[model samples]
Target chain A: MDTNDYIVQVQDLYYRYDKENVLENINLSIKKGSFLAIVGPNGSGKSTLLKLMLGLIKPQQGLIRLFGQDINKFKEQHKIGFVSQKANSFNTGFPATVFEVVASGLTKKLGLFNFLRKTDHVKIKQAIESVGMGKFLDRNIGELSGGQQQRVFIARALVSEPELLILDEPTVGVDVQNVNSFYGMLETLNKEKGITLLLVTHDIGTISEKVTNVACLNKNMHFHGSAEEFEQLKINDVSEIYGHDVHVLTHDHHHHGGGHLHD
Target chain B: MISGLLQYEFLQNAFLTGMIIGVIAPLLGVFIVVRRLSLIADALSHVTLAGIAASLLLEKKFMIFSGLNPLYMGMAFSVGGSLFIEKLRTVYKHYQELAIPIILSGGIGLGVIFISLADGFNTDLFSYLFGSVSAVSRADLWTILIISILVIALVVLLYKELFLLSFDEEYARATGIAAKTLHFIFIIMVALVIAASMRIVGILLVSSLMTLPVAASIRFAKGFKQTIFFSILFGEVSVLGGLFLSYYLDLAPGGTIVMIAVLILVLAIWLKKRAATRSI
Candidate 1:
C-alpha cells in the first residue's frame, strides 16, 4: 500500500533465447499490495519478465530483487505463488484431488519429506473457501471445468499464504462468465488480504479495468504507468505495441454486469 | 490355493516374487501411465533384454552360468539406458517421442545380435524369454526382496516430490522441488523394475504388467493415491491369477500374466461403462 513498500524490483534486465534479445533494458518496480498487469501482444517479453521474477528462467543480464534481496538468493519460495496459463500445463489424467492439489502449495514451507500438519489443513480449508471451491475439495482435479480448475489452482497458490501472487494467462480457457467472477475474487484478495498481484495477459480489455498499474511490452517495454495512464493511452502507442492498428471497444459496465462476450 | 503354494519351493519363490512385483509395479506404474511414459518402460525392457543376451553370450560353457541372478547386470544396463533416454529427450525437446523408437529399435537389434552370438537358445533361455517359475533361485529371491525395499523406500521418501514433478514439472521447479533430479531418479527406478521383471514377465510383457493395472484403476478410483491403491490391488490379482494359471495350464507365465491383466483391463472398462449408463 505504501510507495516505500517495494516487493519486486527489476533493474536493466536483459534476456535472450539464443541470439534474439528479449526484455532488454527492462526496469520496473512493483509495490506491495498492488495489482499489476503485464500486457502485450504475442512474442512480447511479458511472460519472460514474470518467469525472471519467479526464477523459472535466468536473465542474461541485470538484477531482479524480490523482497529486497537478489531474486536468485531468495530461498523463501513459499512466500510466492504461481499459476500458469489455463491449459492445465500438466498431465491432464493425473489423479490428484482438489485437496491434494491445493495441499501441494505447502511444499516449500513443509519441505520435501514431511507430512502435512494440522495447521496446513486449516490453511488449505481457508484457501478452498476463499476460491469458493470448499465443496469440491474431495473431487478429482481433472473432473472440474476450466473455470473450476482455475479456481482450484488459485486455491493451491493461496494455501501457502503468499505475499506475492504471479499468474500467467489465468483466464485463457475459462468461460466468459466465470472470468468476471474470477477477477472479482482476485480483486478481493488484493484489497482485503493485501496480496501483491502480478498478472501476465494479452487481454487488456478485461484486466485493465481492475489493475492498479499496467506495463505494455513488445520484446522490450513500450509503455509503463498506472492503469489510468494506460486508459488515456494514444491509439498510435497501442498500435505500435501490437505492431498493427488495434481497436478495442471500451465497455464501462462490463466489469459490473453479470457477463459480456467481447469477441 | 494355500496347499498348492506350499507344495513346491519353486512355487513358493514364484508366489512371493509375484506378490512383491504385484505391489511395486502398480505403485510405480500409476505415475508412469499418467505421465504417458509407459512406452519408455517398454523401451527400457528391450534394453534389458540386450543386457541379458550380452551376459549370456559372454559366459563360457564350462564356466557354469547362474540362471536368474544375471538379472542384476541387466538392471545396470537398463538404468544406463534410462539415463541415455533422458538425455535424448532433453536434446530433442519437441520431437521427444523420437527417443522411444531410437532406443527400442536399437535395443532389439542389439539383443538379436547378442542372442545370435550366444550360439544357441537353450531351455534356460526359452524359459527366460517366455517366463518360467522353474528358474527361481534363492539368490533371485534375495535380489527381488532387496530391490523391492529400495523401490518402496525411494517412493516413500520422495512421494510428494515425485507426484509434483510428474503432474506439473514447471510448477515443481518453480516451487524449488528439484524436478530434474527427481525425474532422473524415477526413470532409474522404472529401469530397475523393468530389469528385475524381465525374468518373470519377459521383455514382451513387462511393460503390460506396469501399465494394465493403472489403466484399470483409473476408471473408478477417485484420486491419485486411491488410483495407486487400486492399481496395486489389480496387479496383485493379475500376477497371482496368472501365476496359478501358468502352473496348471502348462503355459508361459509371462504370456499368461499379460493375458490376465488385459482381461482385467477389459472388465474394468466394461464395468465403468455400465456404471455410467446406470447413473444416467
Candidate 2:
C-alpha cells in the first residue's frame, strides 16, 4: 500500500504504566476515509492506545506514524481532531457558549497572539451546524443535555476541519435514545464528509454496522479485519479476548431493520 | 475625596495600584475558579506572608535591609510556594488536593516563627497584614504597575491555550498545547498577581479579591468572556468602593474590600434565585 493512503500506522507499539503492561507489540494501520472501531472489554488499554497514537503518551518501543510522518515529528496536529471520554473532559458548570467551545478548536492552529478572523467565525458556525447544533450556538454548554454536549464537543473537533477524527467513548454518558443518532452522525461524517474515524467504544452493539473495520483489542490486538469478518468471529475468540466466558448475539431491530451485535 | 486624591501622593499611589490590581486579580481568578484551584491562591498568600515576615525580621536585624520593600520578598516566596505545590501535586497524584493544606500550614508555621523572631507585630507589619490606605508608597505603585503589565501581556498571549487547559487539560495536552509549560507560566502569573495585590487587598485578604468576584460572576454569565467581564467589573467595584469607604470610615482597606466582595456575591446568589423563580 502507498504510504499516503494510510493515515495512522503503528508498528510494534508497547506501553506500560508502572509495573503493568497495558499494550504490547501492537501493529495497526488506519486508511484514510475509513471508519475503524476499536472495541474491547474493561482494562483493554483501548484509551492508552488512542493516547499513544495521539502522542499524549509515548510508546516504550516501536514506531507510529501519522500521515506517513513519524509521530514525534508530526506537527500538523490540526489535521487530526480528538474528543476524549465525554464524562470526564469538561466541567458541567463551565460558563461557555456552544459557539465559543467550537471556536476553541482553531486555537492551536491559529497559534498564540493571533485573533480569530471573520472567516474563522464562518467556519465555526459551519461546524456547529454540521453537528446539528446551529440553534444552540448561543446557548450555554452546561445547559445542554448530555447528548447535546457531546454534539457540541464533536462540533468543536470538527471546527478545525480535521481529516482524521478520533473519539474515546463519545457516547459514555449519552442516553440510549441519543446514542443511535450520535452514531448516525458519526456515520455521516465518515461517509459524507470523507473524514477518517477512529473510535474507542464499548457500544459494540449499535456501532458495528456503521464502522467499516473493527479491531478487537485486549493488551494485544486480538483481531483486525472488516466489520463483516468481525460479525462472523467465533464466540470463543471474543471470549478469549475478553478473558471470560462470553456470548455474542445478533438481533435484527424491526424498527430500523438493522442488525445489532450484543454480548 | 476627589481633591484629596490630587493633594497626597500616598492616596494616588494606593488608588492607582488598587485600580491596576482590580483588573488583573479577577481576570486570572476566572481561570483559577474554573480549574478548581481557588485554595491554591490562599496557600500562596499565606506563603507570601511568611516572606513578608522574614523581610521584616531581616530589616530589624540589619540596617542595610531596612529600606528594602517586603513585597519583593513576598513575591519570591509566593512563586516558590506555587512551584512546590505543583511538585507535591505530581508526587501525590491520587490525593492532589493534599498539597494545598500542607503548604498553607507550612507557610503559617514559618510566618509565626519569623514574626516571633522580630519581637511581634509592629506598625509596618500591621499595615502589610490588614492594608493601610496611606501605606502604599510610590515605589510600591511602580512595582505593581510593572507586574500588572507583564501579567496582562502574558494572559493576552496565552489566552487560548489557558482556556483549553483550564477547560479540559487532557484534551489540551493531546492537542499539543504544552500543558506543563503553560501550567508553570500560569502558576507564576498567579504568584505575581497575588503579590502585586497584597499592597491593596493585603496578604490576608488577597485571595478573597482574586476569587470573590468570580464567585459572583458564575451566577449568571452566559459565556467565558462574559464571566471574565463581570468578574473584573465586580473586582473594580469592590476595590474602588472599599478604598472610598476606608478613606471616610477610617477602616482597613483589606477588610472593607473583602466585605464588599462578599456583599456582591450574596447579591448575585439572591438575584440568581429570584430569576430562577420568575422563570418557573
Candidate 3:
C-alpha cells in the first residue's frame, strides 16, 4: 500500500478499561486527504477508538500505524493535530490571548528551549486568520464567545500545519445555527490544504453532507463505507448497534453532541 | 526612604533584594496561580521553615556549621519538598490535589518538631518567621541575586513549554512534550522562588507574594503576558511600599508586603466590578 493511502490504520486493536472489553478486534483506516466522520451512540466506543489511534492509551493486543509508522514509534506527532472534547472545558479565566493559544500548537515543531520566532509568529497569525479570528488576536480567550473560543482551539491545532486533523465533538459548545458554517471552514481546510480530517461527532444529520466517508463504530467497526452508502443504512441496523431505536436524518434539531434523538 | 539607600548598608541590602524578588515571585506565580497549584508554594515555604529551624539549631550545636545562612538550607528543603510533592501527586494519581495537604502538614509537623527541639522561637527564628529589614546581610543579598538570575533564566528558556503545560497537560503530553520533566523543573523553580522570597516575606507570608499579585492580575489582565506583567508590577509596588513602611514604622517586612498585596487584590476586584457594571 502507498504511504499516502492510509494515514491511520488500526488492525486487531483491543482495549479494556477495567475488565470487559471497550474495543474488541476493531480494524479501521483513515484514508489520506479524505474527510471521515466516526459516528456512534454515547457508549459506542468512538472516543476509545480515537484514543487508541492517538497513542494516548496503549492497546492490549493490536497494532496502530500512523503515516506508515507504528504509532508507538511515530516521532512525527506534529503531523497529527487533535482538537479534543475538553477544548470547551478550558478554564474560562485562563489569561492567554488567541495568538498565545495558537502559538502553543507549534510547541511540538519548535522543540524545547526554542522561543517563538518572528516566522513562528507569522504562522500563528496565519492560523488565527485561517479560523477567521484575526481581529481577536490580542483578546483574552475567556473574552471570546464559545464558538469563537472553539475556533481559536481549532486554530491552535491547525498552527502546526498537520497532515491529519482529528476532532472529538468539535461542535459541543458551538451554537446551533453556526454549526454548519463551522464545518464549512473545516471542509475548506481539507480541500484547500489537503489535510485529512477525522471527526468523532454525533451531528450525523448536520455533517452528512460535508463528510466524504462515515465509520459507524460500536465496540467493533459496524460500518465503514462512503457517506452516500451510510445514508442508505437501514434504521433498524443502527438501532441494533445502539441497543435501541436510532432515527438517523430525522431532522434532529438538538444542537449538543450528547443528543440521543431516537424513538 | 530614598535617602536610606545612600546611608545604611542593611537598608540597601533589603531594598535591592526585594526589587529582584518582586520580579520573579509573581512571574513564577502566574503559572502557579493558573495551574491552581498555589498551595504548593505555601507547602514549600513551610518546609523551608523546617530547613531554617534545623540550620539555626545546627549553627547553635555545631561550630563548623556556624556563620552559614539558613536560607541556603531553606532553599534545599524547598526544592526537596517540591520533588516530594511531585512524587505524591503521581502516587495518588486520582486525588492529585491531595498532594498539597499531605506535604503541607508533613512540613508543618517537621517544622514544629525542629522548632521545639531548638527550644522554641528565638530572636533569629522570629525574624525568619516575620521578615526583618535590619537583619538582611550582604551575603543574603548576593545569594538572592544569584537565585533570581537562575530562576529568571530557566523561566525565560522554558516559557512556552511551561505555558502549554499549565494551559493543557493532556495536549502537551500528546504533542510529545515531556510533561513530567517540564513539570518537575517548573516546581523546582517554584521552590526556589519560595525559598528566595522567604527571607524578605518570611516563610508564613511567602505564599502571598507568589499568589496575591497573580490573583489580582488575573482579574483584569487581558493575556498571559499582561497578567505576568501586572503580577510583577503589583509585586514590586507591594515590596517597595512595604519595605519603606517597615523601615520607618518598625513593622515586620513580611506582614507589610502581604497586606499591600491584599489591598491591590481588593482594589482590582472593585475596579473590575465597576468596569463590568459600567459596560452593562
Candidate 4:
C-alpha cells in the first residue's frame, strides 16, 4: 500500500522519559479505515506512543507521520480527534451540558476569532445524537453515568469530523455492562463511518476481538499483526511481554461464564 | 438614587463603571472559577493595589506623575503581575498554586511599602481602598469603557476556545489549539478586568466581584453558556442593587456590592438544595 494509504506511520521511534527508554525501535503503520488497538501491561509505554502519534510529545528519535505528513509538520490537527481518559478525572461540578461539551470539539476548527454559527450547532447536535446521547443533550455532563460521559466525550471528538480518532483507556470508568455496547459503538464508528481508530488500553482482552489489528507493546513492539494472528499466539508468548503471568480474558469472561462455572 | 445618579457627574461615572465591571468581571469569572484560577484574580487585584500605591506615591513626590490617573499605573502592574504569575507557574510546575500566594504577598508587601513611603493613608487612599462613588473621574470611566469593550469582544470571539481550554486542557492541546498563547491572553484579560473593576469594587473586594457571582451561578446553571449568563445576571443585580442601596443608605459601594453578592450566593445554594430535596 502507498504511504498515503496509512493514516499513521511510525518508524524506528524511540522515546525516553528520563534515563530509561519508554519505547524502543517502534515501527507502527495504521491503515486508513482500520481499527487498531495497542495493548500492553502497566508501564508498557503504550500511552507514550499514543502521545507521540498525537504530537503531544516529540519522539526522541525516528520518524512519525500522520496522514502522510511529518508529525512536526502536521498542521491539520482538527482532522485528528482525541478523547483522553477524562471520564474519571473530570470535575463532577463542572457546569456543562453534553451539547456544550460536544460543541467544544469545533473550537480549533472554527479558529480563535470565529463564534459558533448555525451550522456548527447542527453538527454538534448530530455528533451527540450519533453517539446515542441525543436524549442527554441538555443534561449536565457531570450528571451522566461514566459510560454515558465517555459517550459524550466521544461525541465531542466526533464533532470535528476527524479522519483519525485516538482514545486512551476510554473504558477506564465505563461500566462492565455497558462496555460491550461502547465497543459496538466504536465498531460502527470505524466500520460504517470509515474513520481510522488508534486506541490505547491495558485491558487487551476486552478489545482484542473488536479491533482489526493489535499491537502488543511493552518496551518494544512484541506483536503487531491482524487480531486473528494475535489471538492465535500462545498464552505464554503474550504473557512474556507483561513480565508476569497474565490471563487473556476475551470479554466472554463476562458472558457464558456462569455455564462454565456450573459445568 | 436615580435622581442622585442623574444630578451628579461622579455618580454617573461610578454607576457606569459599576455596570461595565458587573458584566465583564463575572463573564470572565465563569472561566476563572471553572479553571480553578480564582486565586489568580485575587493575586492580580493585590498587584493592582501595588500599582495604585506606587502611582499615588509618584504623584505626591514627582511632578511628572501628577495629573495622571493611578488606574493606568495599576493597569500596568496588574498586567505585569499576570505575566509573572504565568512565568512562576512554569517555574514551579508541580506546585502551580504556589505562584498565586507568592504574587499575592509580594503585591501586598509592595503596596504597604508604597503607602508608607507616601505618608500613609489619606482621604484619596481611603476612597481607593473602600471604594468612593464620588472619586471616579470622567477619565477613569473612559478607560474602563474602552477596556470593557475590548474584554467583551475578545470574550465573545474566544468563548469556545476558552471553554475548551478550561474544560479539558489536555484535549485542547491535543487539538493543537495554541494552548500556551491562548492561556497567556486569558491571564492578561484577567489582569485587565481586575484593573477595570477596582474603581467601583475597591482593590480588596474586586476579586469578590469576579468570583462570587460565578459561585452563585454554578449552583443553578445547567450548562456552560447558561453559567456565564446567570453569572452576569447575578453580577448586574449585585452591582446595581448595591449601588442604589449604598447611595440611599450612605454605605460603602465596595462592601455593599460584595455583601449583596454573598447573599445571592447563599440564596442560590439554598434554592438548589431545596429543589434537590423536593426531587428526592
lDDT of each: 0.84, 0.90, 0.88, 0.89
Clashing pairs in 2: none
lDDT at residue B76 of model 4 (Cα atoms): 100
In candidate 3, position B251 carries an lDDT of 86
Name the lDDT of candidate 4.
0.89
Fnat for the candidates in order: 0.74, 0.87, 0.79, 0.87
In candidate 4 chain A, where is summed lDDT lowest over 10 consecutive residues? Answer: A254-263
Say which prediction, candidate 2 or candidate 4, comes out ahead on DockQ: 2
- Badly placed stretches (over 4 Å) of model 1 are A1-4, A234-237, A240-244, A250-263, B61-68
Proportion of native contacts present in model 1:
0.74
- What does candidate 3's lDDT look like per residue over B1-280, in tens digits? 7887999999999999999999999999999999998898989998998899889888878899998899899989999999999889889999999989988898889888888887776688888888878878999999889988998999898988999999988888888898889988888888988888888888889999989999999998888999999999999999999999887898889999999999999999999999999999
lDDT of 3 at A183: 90
Give the per-residue lDDT of model 4 (tens digit) for B1-280. Answer: 7887789899999989999999999999999999999999999999999999999999999999889899999999999999999999999999999999999999999999999998886788777777878889999999999998998988888888888889988888889878899899999999998998988878889999999999999998999989999999999999999999998999999999999999999999999999999999
- Of the pair 2 and 3, which is ahead by DockQ? 2
User: RMSD (Cα, Å) of candidate 3?
Assistant: 2.1
Query: Between the candidate structures 3 and 4, which one is better when assessed by lDDT?
Result: 4
TM-score of each: 0.94, 0.96, 0.96, 0.96
Candidate 2 reaches a DockQ of: 0.84
Please provide TM-scores computed only on chain A for all of the candidate models, following their numbering.
0.91, 0.93, 0.93, 0.93
Q: How do all the candidates rank in terms of DockQ, highest first?
A: 2, 4, 3, 1
- Chain B TM-score in each of the candidates: 0.95, 0.98, 0.97, 0.98
Worst 10 residues of 4 chain B by lDDT: B121-130
Off by over 4 Å in 4: A87-89, A243-263
